[model samples]
Target chain A: MTGHPHDHGHAHAPAAAEDGPPSEYARLGRAVREILVEKGILSAADVRRAIEAMDARGPHLGARMVARAWHDLAYKARLLADGTAAAAELGIEMGPTILKVVENTAAVHNLIVCTLCSCYPRMVLGIPPDWYKSRPYRSRAVHEPRSVLAEFGTVIPDDVEVRVHDSTADLRYLVLPRRPAGTEGWSEAALASLVTRDSMIGVSLARSAHEPVETA
Target chain B: MSDTPLRRHHDMGGLPAGRVERADHVLAAWEKEVDALLVLLSRQGIIRVDELRRGIEALPPDAYDRLGYYERWIHSITAALVEKGVLTQAEVADRVATIAAREEAER
Candidate 1:
């Protein structure tokens, strides 16, 4: 009681209710769900299944797709034109999503985001991780990709160009990062070890197992 | 004869943004839910198997066919419903209207 102010000496009572009730995002999601059910576009069971599939096979499928694109050139071209067919080539079945792959080359660095909403390539790339849906990343990634990539520890040189793709159409995107050096004779599986999820999203470059993943 | 003063460029009215993030969020949630409902109803023997199959068949092939596993099956039902007239365009429009109206009322 002498020097500093006595702040919350009662061991800090439990926090009060949230400032404003449900967030806008939650409200919107609820309203949309109601509309979909009423319109016969969606059902409760469908949501459950989607959540399940997202947990089970989404990431593995994305990893496999990235691996395949790394090893094959002709297949990569095919993927660019038609992602669904390309995915099928690798025997990764497509349910109903028509995915599109966008390759990132020496000159162009491709980034993907759904400006309208989170229209990720779930069929191929899998359900986007939570970070992709965050407001700051979602809003800024498209507009300032290089800066974002830098934050992720993959800095593109001044000469390199950056192109951000907004996944609004039925098509989705996956970045085919340029092949890394010193791994000339490596097998496809070995090459695949380097294709991190962040790399596939064009936010960072792929790194070998030897190169430690930089903490965010 | 007097002439009317020219309208100020800054005074012109503006339309709202074409795309609404909140609306998209809701619609996406709805689409997923709708697709799942059809699948569940079909599995539960509530909706005819053939009818569900028909609905799935009605989805846009380019988009739906590329969907993975369950989603493919789900969208198929959406197509079938559209074809069977179980889910009509007018019905969808009406539902959207209702949601919009409710939102306006809340505001």
Candidate 2:
């Protein structure tokens, strides 16, 4: 599956810089907009409205999928077996343009990285977070997933295993980490509480009621 | 130009950012890609070199550090363009409408 080929090239460097207190990118964008108007490529009103829309969409439906699976065993099983279908079952539809989701399980601890560029499953997981598309995470994750995980403060047991899923083509992955112990009667919402974005990407495990960790 | 996107061919390692060594490797690659883009866009007249240079200079010392990754750049650009009217609201609405239509049609 492919995503909307939004500009993923070098043409965006100056504008792609990080936002500070005042957000320099915003200022640069204004400059770029002025140039575009002078060149007759776009109108000011049009650009302002479009940015508003992008923000409204927020993260993709995949975050909900992860939350659901954390609470239900059968759904988690189905998600693991057929991610695209399972997601639809929850009203999360995938388009021809949308990338398919792959669930990484315990036998194979699935990790996601976009090595070449940031091709991701945005429809489900929202936008691929910044770190997922970086060159370092992509390059080293494939070469040394364990070492990479350790950097994130995630230490996989020797027996748990690791499997890195490159986010390319139509196949983007979400890790269905093994549910932690000590929360037998936890509600789905409660379980969802433990499913951090990092764990969903498979670098860490979902927190159990007993061993809670910081999730941002 | 008309091939499977090159991003699919390269291998991405892990998530939540990797170790400094891995992080450095990835950031360097993205920075290189960004530089290449600056040059190419300038050649295409999509951007001016002086303007780009000024913009680059104006960047916060921790601009990249605050965001700390390349994909953030991609996200912000996409967001900023959409905001600045470089991308059209109607275009996004129409694409979304088209996707919704196709789904209804499929069912």
Residues A1-216 of candidate 1 have per-residue lDDT tens digits of 111101222122222232123233323333434555555655544656654554455555666677666677777778788888888887876664577777777788888876544557666666566556544466667666666677777788888888898776566777777777776776777777777777777877877647753442
List the lowest-lDDT window of 10 residues for candidate 1 chain A: A1-10
Clashes of 2: 19
For every candidate, C-alpha RMSD to the true structure in Å:
14.5, 14.3
**Residue range A1-216, candidate 2, lDDT tens digits:** 111112322122222223322233332333334444445665434443333333333233555677677677788778878887887897765544434445555556777776655555554655455566555676787778888788888887788667776665657666665667776776766666676667777776676677664543
Computed on C-alpha atoms, the DockQ of candidate 1 is 0.07
The residue ranges of model 1 lying beyond 4 angstroms of the native Cα positions read: A1-52, A212-216, B1-107
Q: Which ten residues in a row have the lowest lDDT in candidate 2 chain A?
A: A1-10
- What is the C-alpha local distance difference test score of each model? 0.57, 0.53
**What is every candidate's C-alpha DockQ against the true complex, given to 2 decimals?**
0.07, 0.12
